[model samples]
Target: MTDPVDRDSRVPALVRLTVDLSALRYNYRRVASVGERTAAVVKANAYGLGAARVVETLRREGCRDFFVATLSEGVLLRAVDREATIFVLSGPVDEESAFAMVRHALTPVLNDATQLQWWRAHRETPAAVHVDTGMHRLGFDYRSFSASIFEGFNVGLVLSHLACADDPPHPMNERQVARFESIRSLFPDAVGSLANSAGALSGMASGMTRAGIALYGGNPFVTRPNPMATVAVLESRVIALRTVAAGEPIGYAATYTTAQETRVAVLGVGYADGFPRGATRDARVAYGASRLPVVGRVSMDLLHVDASTVGREIALGDWVEIFGHTIGIDEAAAWSGTISYELLTRLGGRVARCYTGS
Candidate 1:
């Protein structure tokens, strides 16, 4: 019936997210090995792992092309890398954004007719052209797109998003490739591209594949093993210990009850720290090879884990591995009913990012 002790500063922050720069660099090389050239997709703050550090690492490793989802992201990357090429996937919709792109020396990936005309008229340097093969999200439709649309413009590359490259055998893969091939032929002077992380991993992406999820070591192929290095380690601290009586209800809404006299270790991470809010039985924290299974419902600020398996070896301020070298991101994401990209990107800002092995 005593209050839980706070172990702030002793553990050097409640949560520590370690990013392996060496692994990231290796992933870049692996992706580039498939395509002659590679464009690093660093959108969403490098999938919420800090784009500045990621960009600097890639730049040092000989990466020249970078892709971001917005003009602001492009500007942020431009500050980090002075000489590398920055491509804005989400092109400017207004005249001011186009001016910002020119001023920042960011290349816009023109998708629609409006973006096309704006870049055609205002772009001082070169810009990429996106033709819609099948994604139907961005890019111009190839059937209606004519050659005269890009006359006299400096088109650096023609790119398209694959609808089903992860499935490899999906008919959309061949269809998109064929369609993208025909579309890029009209602009023979421009470099052709039609792949993402999955495409790059499977060797389906041709001519300058843009890699996103795979860079952080997330498995791009569904049926095969993950070949990339472990680039990140998410961790939390054991704050309080309590003994729960058998059949005692635990956490919010009393979702779980202790099956026996159990030892519980409260961890300092929850929904606010990007751990799901309702991960009761499905979530588990790893301590070396042993798994500390989650016993109660997760909350906004904390989660409860059964430590009876560890006996008394676990103590206050001890670190618990959420996902790292031992636990794959895809495995953790699956337990949380989500994907690796969503899990990685949704990590809250409060967690401290510690880069290593640069």
Candidate 2:
């Protein structure tokens, strides 16, 4: 059978990033039915999947709340949808950043006593207060945060981070839930939020749930499959195909030496394109219905795939799929010794993004 035409003829550059809008909407719908208001965490460029576009699409789907990592991120997101309820996860640090919030009407997630004090003294701005349940990254210290901080601040929401909710039965999960309960009791007026993607799946009771990785369909827990699991794999065209003799090496460092004559195809992706270095010769790329194994160490701009098994005439400009429906995000993360979040978010900005329907 002849393979279908898969190349995007308009911009036939070296590479591109394809985003499935339908899959995104599907994932959003799948997780939004938990009875809690879901906010799409588009911080880190929607985990490097093009934040602006994702936000616009989600907003059209009635997603009013959006979370970002920094004031700058909030500003960028606001440019997309000014009316969206945007929260800065990494609360402001200086007068300028704090002022940006008031000017833009962006809500900052106050993480500490200092931020609370700054907000109280400078302006009674609309803001969210984060409680440090277990993650030592950001949030107010429950022991040190004085009641005065809560007394005067215009708290729009009171939220906490879940340390091990992905592990469900982990002790930290219960401890955090208990602590958050106390916080809720203390600030009953403020909207309570504590569940992240994993915590949301844990069936925790919270007012708002932040779906970070799950919005992109990366597993919130281990590398297992479950509901709401999808992946956005990038497919680049193969510009060249050739046959190599036995004992011939592939890629940098001559890391992969062919045992026999091998047919290899050069694909348009590399470390610079967000295909991690470790994914080198061990990773797999797809061409139509054929699965091609990567050969040699991955380069900064390109890599080779062994297509010896497919005896058909493999031509140049064939589409090669990387890290999508076939290869889950968790599996791709394993090749990099990192988590699915990193892989999804760290996708280089150079790649062009195209979205499909759910």
Candidate 3:
């Protein structure tokens, strides 16, 4: 059997993902400038950009707090930084999980009565309380708010999620904020956190702001232009080029046909590499200044780009930017009929991830 390391050294990766730590730090500063205590939400492995590296970068920028979706995610992050406060958004599910959280010095964000009781029974260490302010996903409902239940408990933080913060004009934002304020008042001693990435950018944060997607260069708002710096750049190399006669079909099921004699470049990336297969609608890849529209459906291992404009300038092994400084991630996500969060997190493991600008 061939050694994997030796095989890797012999063959070059077709697709590459470059993460800019400097840009991540810059984004952290931008989110922190929102006038609230900023807590880095490094959940989903920092949105699949590698949690350990992202956490290290954020720590250097003076980020002391971090949030993760699960207890296991918190445990993994705890291994990255011994000092940074890690909050488990899913909280403890049972006794064993609660013990693990206490052992790792992870703070659980109690969402419901069961989690709160679990935390109270196992440990007295400070934990956060999540109040449901209209998202209806997690957190204790506002109608059931009771200060007595947390009388002897050390509630260190009170947070609520914003569902429509991305849609700034949505009336739900104001309503959720109002409900969160009422619930937060009940826990006067605990720190109040009511904003996410979009909320922080739009000046809706309070005591603490949980910055998620925006820190990774994803536009938090739906319509507003992305204000954050670019952090991740995805690129693929051209493996083959061919000339197709007019009326010839290309790719599986012949979804796209050559309207005229056209030059096509076969990229060494596809849905298997996290390039959305459904992005063929209006998706284009960048080669220098020329934008080559993607024609035909994206396959598992390859996709064809209409390189007629670039002509002879394009050659085999030339790299094309899938999304990066030249093409915005949000724009790419739109082409995929998805959101930036999905696009970033869906990046497959086969794609090489390189860290830069540290």
Candidate 4:
């Protein structure tokens, strides 16, 4: 629980997403030990934890491979770094964006036979081919994979995505693995890759695994332990505090009525800052060492919490942890009825991210 900011130094008032760089490095190294090269997925700004900084840190930690979801993200990641192996997961759509892939030196994951053909016709650099076994979002159909679609291009990695690896013993787990293994033999020169964070943790094939959410310490497979670093916590300042009489309504539409004479502490964070609106009266914000229950409904700019039991020392300008340290991301996601990955990825750009440790 080291202080995120320099307590003795002066800094501007802003929402800070304090990141533990050391924890991230430790998680990458730990996940890489599973006997395969770990490609850090920096898609969606590294799941809302700033892609540029995430790639920079991971690169320094010896991560040579990186994955981004979109062409734009690939461009931004390439801007930050040029030497690392940056792969675009969306693959190429047409000739226009394909040139961007070449310009940025991004290796597109060819998902379909058409894109494969498109790349084979227009692409000059090495590209990865995605074969769909299940989780039919991207990648080529199981039937078309054996066609001449991938004949001429220099394929870097024969990739497939995992859908049910989070379930561990899910029937689809072995099915997709078997399918990927079967088809991968067709392309001998290309390296094989299967497994995401969950796949790697589930003892899947020993190929390159793309570590995304788990690298940031989220367990997609809740049954098993999270195989990464500590959860990232977020804290914001309480800008105001006041006493409300019993039966007084709070927030818009008078959704929450105060039970008794209550003390409310207003936090600076709100939905616009990526705090979910569903985080209503059930959510709790941590103040100092004690947890204060958020009363009433969450608003766009602020949320109120009961702090009557909190001492008078707690006042305006005091800091309250919204999701990190005590209130884990899992709890926050549960309260919001979403996964921790959503919570992390939805963290808005308005909130400033501050990095700590090496």
**Could you say which candidate leads in lDDT?**
3
lDDT, candidate 2, 38-95, per-residue tens: 8999888888778877887888777899998988888777777768889998888977
- The root-mean-square deviation over C-alpha atoms between each candidate and the true structure, in angstroms, is 4.8, 4.6, 2.9, 3.5
Q: How accurate is candidate 3 locally (lDDT)?
A: 0.89
Worst 10-residue lDDT window, candidate 4: 1-10
- Total clashes in model 1, counting residue pairs 3 or more apart in sequence or in different chains: 0
- Per-residue accuracy of model 4 over 175-259 as CA lDDT, tens digit each: 8888989988888777788988878876774768898887887775877765566647687788888999999998888988988
Off by over 4 Å in 3: 1-11
TM-score of model 1 relative to the true fold? Answer: 0.95
Q: How would you encode candidate 1's per-residue C-alpha lDDT over 279-298 as one tens digit per residue?
A: 54667888768898887788
TM-score of 3: 0.95
Which residue pairs of candidate 1 clash? none
Give the better candidate number (1 or 3) by TM-score: 3
Whole-model lDDT values for every prediction? 0.84, 0.78, 0.89, 0.79
Q: Which residues of candidate 4, in runs, are more than 4 Å off?
A: 1-11
Q: Point out the worst 10-residue segment of candidate 3 by lDDT.
A: 1-10
